[model samples]
Target: MNDFFSTTILIATVASGIRLATPFLLASLGEALGQRSGVLNLGVDGVMLMGAFVAYFVVLKTGNPLIGAAAGILLGMVFGLVYAFITVNLHAEQGVSGIGIYLFGLGMSDLLFQKLVGTPLPIMPFPEIHIPLLADIPIIGPMLFTHSLIVYVAFLLVPAFTLLLNSTTYGMNIRAVGENPAAVDSLGVSVTKVRYSAIIIGNGLAGLAGAALAIELGIFQHNLTNSMGFIAIALVYFGAWRPFGVMAGSLIFGMVAAIVLQGKTLGIIPRSASDLAAMAPAVITIFALVLVANRFKQPAALSKPYERGR
Candidate 1:
């Protein structure tokens, strides 16, 4: 406990926490976008898995992180189109469709990996980009500055997304569609179009999130996301469906996870219990959500298919 109080160790832990939070922040922001447009995509996990594999394969072949990230986003956007088609256009059961997507991604990613690269191989990840003067500042510097391009991009997106939801025309359309599709439809806005766009954006972000995760880790395997996608969905609720809230939720999870890992390393937690220790962040998130479950409201039409005629 005393050792944990040291300034250097604390800063390192916080820096690591920020790094760990990137994937969650990206995925949660994407989901928040979809939910705001009245779409609930529970298959974000599957999307992430697919994105991770795609990014990994791209980086393995090209040795370029930028191309890998783009590939992930592209692959995810294509799948997002399928998800939007089923739920938004065809009016399939959103929940069931999402589960099917999840299963498909899970199986397909593993299958492709096995067939393409039977043995796991190492790959280059994103290179860290440090802000010149800011990185040299005291504790806050490293925790906030020195990080990969995706990390900065992920955090920057919070404000950009918040502005999009709160101040932009498209943002208003999304909120209007989510809260009252009939009203939006009556006003000449296409409900399906808005929802489709939202879904694509969400899935694209999820893909980027997966790609970032795989690139940062420099490796991939079955279930690489390890249910982090579900955790991102929970973050939407935990954030009360707001971008800043979602960011906060992600940071909390990241910090807790970093702490847990630090504990294992410091021998504060027995090696035998490391697995259980890892559950701490998710458990904490669940408990936090439970406490505030009734306090926040989600988009009114979330999970309900919208048909202009019906």
Candidate 2:
């Protein structure tokens, strides 16, 4: 009986992990797109933080969660625009500029939170949407189908991203730019334009991830992601720049997190050990990177900005 119960708990934990990983999967997929287009936006953390704060506040003010989601998308687009200005237009170092954007977004989010909400009350959360038939399954039902709309959107994005990268004309252009910007430039395709678009789209996805963390999880605290943003970025590499691979990596990390948190609650693991378990995802990411570093080949112009001669 005890072993059976433990097995059930472990199965449930894995299911929950996939749900938790949805945000990471979505964020990393967006980053992969940008990286594949020759732009590396490190401001992903900041973008997500701002998106969370703004989306939560919007929901509170409007009494509509969908409005909050819209706010998240809009803020994400703005974050992308800022990244484009600093890196794409100014010919700045993509890595350094991304760090600057991260700092700016973090400070801005904190300032806005202090000014608007005064750090007193809690922000409202989004509602769940249960799938008709699928949500009725034994253990998998609630775990997969009964999440908020954003969760479903995240899962859908994996295949969508793969299809976009492998089957689209724009994706072809993006690949061309990443592999060899000079060749793309020679063909009259503006490398900067392609990179800028990727950055904007990637940052927008980061924002959505942030909003999901805050509104879906029902908290709007500072540094709410707890370095999940950085982990998402790392997962992109662990996934070897592929959307499906990123999804798999995110699911694994998410499950580890769920097990740690749930195990503490269930007394299967002590609270201290559970805290330690939170480090599992990061450790796994580092290990994966070490193992696959030699096999991975990033975009040729990932960190380079295109500068056309006058």
Measured by TM-score, the strongest candidate is 1
Q: Estimate, for each residue in 180-283, the C-alpha lDDT of model 1 and write its tens digit.
A: 99999999988888998999999999999999999999999999999999999999999988899999999999999999988888888899998999899999
TM-score of 1: 0.97
> Residue 7 of model 1: what lDDT?
79
* Candidate 2 accuracy as TM-score: 0.93
Model 2 per-residue lDDT tens digits across residues 1-310: 2542565676677667877897798789888988998888888888888988888888878767778878887899888988888887898898888888788878888889889987545556667788999988877776677777888898899899888888998888988888888888888998878887888888888988988888877768777766677888898888888888888789878877786777666777777676677787778768877786559898887878887653
Stretches of candidate 2 off by over 4 Å are 1-12
